[model samples]
Target chain A: MSSLSRTTFASLIFGFSFLYLPLIFTAIFAFSDAELAGVWTHFSLKWFKAILNDEDLLIATFTSIRIAGISATVSIILGTLAAAATMNTPRGKYDGYNFLKRIILLPIMIPEIITGFSILMLFMVIESMFGWPKERGILVVAAGHSVASVAYVYATVSSSLASLDQSMGESAINLGAKPIHVFFHITVPLSWRAIVSGWFLAFILSFDDLVIASFLTGPGTSTLPIVIFSNIRVGVTPTINAFVTVFVVITIILASIVYFRTLCLKGRRKGRSATR
Target chain B: MSKKVVGFFLFITLLIVILQWKVKDDYSGEVVNVYGWYGIIPREIFNDFEKETGIKVRYDFYDNNEMLEAKLLSTNNGYDIVFPSFIPYASRQLLMGIYSKLNRKLIPNIKNIDGIITSKFGANGGDVQFLVPLFWGTIGIAYNKKVVSQLLPGETIDSYDVLFDLSKISKLFPYGVSFPEEYIDILPQTRKFLQLKHGGESVTDFQECFRFLEKVRPYITKFSSTTMISDLLSGDVCIAIGASDNAYRAMRSSKAVDKDIQYTLPKKTGILWIDCLGVPKKAPNKRNAYLLINYLLSPEVAAKITNHSGILVNLPAALPLINAEIVTKKDICQSDPEVLEGLTMGCARAENTRELIKAWSQYKTNTHHTSINKEASK
Candidate 1:
């Protein structure tokens, strides 16, 4: 590698370390068996044991997973529909479509505090007006996460659609396949990668959130992030470290799965096309 | 092209329909939403009051007081009641200022508050209207006597300085020590160690306090040990600097079981802390809020929490309700005025507050890794 390339590589390594060092430190302490708190000593599975045994933590994690799953699926559907609708529109309507797209992206692009606050206000207003179940806060949070995720899905899928051969759709119709059948057989399957990417984004955003969760959350509705956030002042204990390390490991594993799956799908698509 | 415009019109119409249907559901007023810090008592106290009063209460709590403040400034938050530490409440001009007066006229139970606190801030702030005294206490060392005496045979365990002596520390203790992580309180802790004044809101005596903490750095194993009090009673730790009320609770439970635990107001003084409750200026249910405040301050209610939580109460009259063992301890109420002042000054050292935090942060950053090693080596 050239000297400049070596320097750039070093910079990337430094950047990754800078962002992730604290998390690594936290992981180390999670396994710490030190008598007095502070420095890491000999490693132990004590904290990990405490976390695995916590029924509340497990339940909270389950709730978060269910919420994330529902949100990701919903976001993918909404995003794909919006993208398809916008892509086929006339040149005169492009300005209006872009405006609407910007609105969809607003929730994620703006500060999280602002987005969370506005949604919370909307919920409070609705609660007062309609006397809805107070657990509506969960629905609101899911909606917020999905709305943010939709923009990412739409952007990715719209670009994918732009790259797709439109002649396939025309030929399918000419061959007596109805529009709906063509969509089901061709459009959706082709957009699966974008849909899955959207799902991943939506799920991660909902799970990692703290600020938005804190604002919209009510009694008995605390997600895992809120639970962990509240316990910071209680001081870092083995149980906390164990809980976090497990959470981190699980996220890393799932992210890798998503990454490898995308690569595999892209490879299969390329192989099929090349053979044809 | 006209067909495309027509389709766009249809889409906009659908969006409008959905928005309108949603907007139609919003109401003007139905609940008095209360956002406050949630914990042992603040979590449960509202339930009783909500039941007694017909005004429906919607309450939520954040762990940190700053989170509460942030919510108040944001439009999404519409809290009728906000409970914040008096210091932060005083500092912020917009979110607070209503607390400048105790207005016993509104809350009749104010008559029973501990004179030390209510008189200091209740209608008594220096032209700054910010908070009512909800609760107050000093920071001190809580210890298991057997472990402590064994650790320090000839040397007396009386000052904050003792925490710096590796020779005196207990090997039995798992967590060497713990303190709050708040930036505001960190500085004062250092200055008070050096007999310095806060000077004013900005902090004056921090340098001296910082120097002292830096001096004591290696001796401290960890400061992120808020749960150390619980550990101390379990004998995982011999001693820790903690809230008086936390110590009292540990001792009360331990003594009943025939276990010996002691909490001390160090000879050099400890930190004093206060937690208070107040209704916002634009509270949705102001009358009901006053009623709730009055109800909590009622002698019976106040006494129940004080005894249960073991924290010092704001109402001096409620002092009688404090766990009998803690109030009756002779060592805590020293014969010497100097020692008593030192203990009282523990939380009140406004002088060196800033210096304390700098020292703590520096220590936390520098010696951050060695805490567990020290324990393991021992």
Candidate 2:
């Protein structure tokens, strides 16, 4: 066997074990009624019952879904349009394009606490000035996440756009089809996979966020991860483990589909692919 | 193959979505929600109270008081019975007003309170009620005797001074001691020591605590809240200092397994903390809360909790009923020694706490590098 294939196989085994071993422990502990994690004398589903009935956690979960959905939609719209514009340009031609990309990435790159603090201060100042208080509710949190998520979506869509045969659009144009028509029919339909995956990817990033959400979230509007974090600060109970197992399973499945689909798409495209 | 896989994925996705959406919290009646810390308190006490008075008790716990305090400070927190650290309760005015109007007639055991604690909560010139002091304890170090014996010079280590004194113990804890990175416990110790050495004031903010924590920074192997107690018992650590109750836990757990564990009472105790119960001003089940407080004050319930939790309760009746075996064994760290040793008295003195807090913050800042379990100390 080639060294490349062997190295790849070894790393895959190591990485999967590293990630899922603890998750498996969490899953195991979720079935038990032991007060402490160490000695497990009994197995019970009581914790799952508590988690399912928890009002605050349920509210936080709903809040996360709503916020994630809104953020993803807004981010993908801006990201796809930006990708559509940027993909055709030769890499070095636009002098300030790199700077624009950096600006878009500032939310994701800087320390989250710093970003959170700055936005909170900015919100405070705006409220004081306008007397509008501009409501730092779920809407503001969604906007904050969208700003960060745009970079991911932009990266995903632009690469997918670049993979398209440039001649296909030109050929359609040559046949007297309008440019907008060519884009809507030919380009969008073909790239829906990337766009949909990017949207889901953005959704996960936004949903899982805690630090930014904690600061930006107004009274009674925290997301699920924030609630989970608050609960964890007290203690780790099997109930929380149950809730988290569900999250783990859901995310793993979503991530697996996203991963394999990209692999298949890239296999077909050949030149550029997500490294996974 | 692909169609079936895709169909299965869609089915699971829809199930999760529906499950998450369908799980909603509907509140009807007869329950007073509580947020507190987990300890030796039994559910039977709460159940008995519920049976006598028809108010159901739903309890939740925070690892430390800060998280609870933060939640209480939020506008919409609906907790009716909030158990906060005595110092934390002292730091805020949120509960003071609610306490001022408690009907003493309903709680016949109110007379059983030790005079000192009663004075702490009782009315002044007017009816200014503070929290009913339920449990009180001193901060000290709890250690595994086996590990600490190894640290002793010629097997003789016995004191807190043996901990930080480099001359007597050159490399006893090369990888520092295990203590939580918290403002309440560590910051105060740093403040007291730094003041003794450098004569600085107290601190209250994160920046100040950063400086405070930095002084003892190198001595800290790792700062953890709840982990330090179990780790010390399991022999992963030589010694850890914070609350005596956790030390009592280590001692009791060892006794259960027939191992020697020692929790040393320091020459000068860092802080005296009290955990108290109070009903919110807007408690839906105020009668139930009153009945529960009365029930907790009962001799049997109080003795069981104080014995199991290793915290000293204020009830005079409860004190006599506690198992003499535990107290005599020093399985519990006593506050009388703490008072005799002159614990900094940080829990009281509300007017002066801000400055103390400021100094405490500075001390924590000093030990910031080793800070992780900031809430653990509380």
Identify the candidate with maximal lDDT.
2
Tell me candidate 2's interface RMSD: 7.5
- Per-residue error at A149 for model 2, in Å? 3.0
Tens digits of lDDT, candidate 2, A36-96: 3432446888777877666667767877887887788778878887876666445688978
Error of 1 at B88 (Å): 4.9
> Model 1 over residues B127-207: C-alpha lDDT tens digits?
223345677666667777876676666656667656645445434234455554554444455556656654443332444
Question: Candidate 2: which stretches are off by over 4 Å?
Answer: A2-105, A118-147, A162-188, A216-276, B1-115, B118-135, B150-176, B183-220, B248-270, B275-344, B347-378
For candidate 2, what is the recovered fraction of reference interface contacts? 0.01
Per-candidate fnat, comma-separated: 0.13, 0.01
